[model samples]
Target: MIQYLWFDLGYTLVSTNREDVYQKVLERFDVFRNREEIAIAYHRADKLFMREYPGVLGKDSRAFFPWYIGTLNYFLRLSLPIEEVLEVQRDVARECPIQWKAFDGAKMTLRHLRSLGYRLGLISNWDESARAVLARNGLDEELDEIVISSEVGIEKPNPDIFRMALSQANVTASESLYIGDNYYDDVVGCQKVGMHCLLINAYGNRGVEELSYHPIITGIQDVAAYLGHPRVQLEINR
Candidate 1:
């Protein structure tokens, strides 16, 4: 029986409007691409980094963004200079510092799970800005505990962080379930601590299916159904 539920921040509970941002930046370079095209390209690039680079996304932005945008451009087949795009992206970031927004049904699902008697928490490999992002999106109050990498000086895939969350929640690993988008960080990290985990592959073909022994969900909204909560199903039907 799972009494506690934990989550990853990026691509799990919240995500940036990468497609919109990328589209706008591309337009400045006179490069034309639809939002769907940009989104697909970004998804491919993101999966490559998540699988190959592992913790690159959690690293310093100065290095990470250039590499990421370069890869995204490859997938998008864009010839625009990477540095120019980065400059534009920085401007966009400054104007909209909080780019993350809760995914559709994220807050509802989390609150619903809390109401269903599960302790909700967050274990994310993110900078100090994570708390502000959660609060801005109204997700902070729904979580009972939030353990971020920068704050604790520890990151995921290390058993210590998972242990920290368990200690804070006062629950054994067996009584908890962690859900996230990254397989290496979320699934493998949970395995190290003897905790069950679920992967969220919104695109459905991110190459994790072959590597993951655990269940994979499309989004946070599927948690109630996955956990066998009939009330959520009933509400959805009506």
Candidate 2:
């Protein structure tokens, strides 16, 4: 029986719409594209980086954004120079620092889970800003612990981090469940520590259907249903 619930921060409980940010940045260069298409392109790029270039997202923004935006541009067929893209990204960052918002129903789902007597915590590969982001969205109050890579010097896909969270929560791996968006990191990492896991594939195109070891949910709201009926196959709600 699952007694403790842990989650990843980015793309799981909270996310910022890069499509909107990139769309506005592209307009400055007279490059217009469909917002939906941009969203798809960004998703593809994100999966590629996450799977092939683990920990790339945790690097300094100066090093990370150019590579990420370049890949995004390639998917969108923008053909813009990386230098120009980087400049626009900087301008946008200055004008409006990237804000991470909790997903729809994220707080409610977490609160419900806690009320049901499940201990809640966070295990994320984020910098010092993880706490601020969670607190800004009022998600921090819903969690019992928050373990971050920057603070622990360990990252997911590394069993040590998962072990740390389990230790901190004083829960056994057999009684814990980890939910996150990354198949390679969250699912694999938690499994290494003998914990159950669920994947959050909101877009349904993350290419993880081939792997059926763990269940998948479209969003955090589906988590409640999964917990209530652990044996039921969850239909992708996207």
In the range 2-49, model 2's lDDT, one tens digit per residue, is 999999999899988667777788888988988889877877887888
Error of 1 at 81 (Å): 1.8
lDDT, candidates in the order shown: 0.86, 0.84
Q: Cα miss at 1, model 1 (Å)? A: 0.9
Q: Between which residue pairs do clashes occur in model 2?
A: none
Over the stretch 1-238, how does candidate 1's per-residue lDDT look in tens digits? 9999999999999998878877777877888999888888877887888889988878886778888888999988977788888888778767555378888677878888999999999999998899999999899999999999999999999999999999998999999999998888999998899999988987775655457356888888888889998534323421
Candidate 1 Cα misplacement greater than 4 A, ranges: 91-98, 207-213, 231-238
Backbone clashes in model 2: 0
Off by over 4 Å in 2: 207-213, 229-238
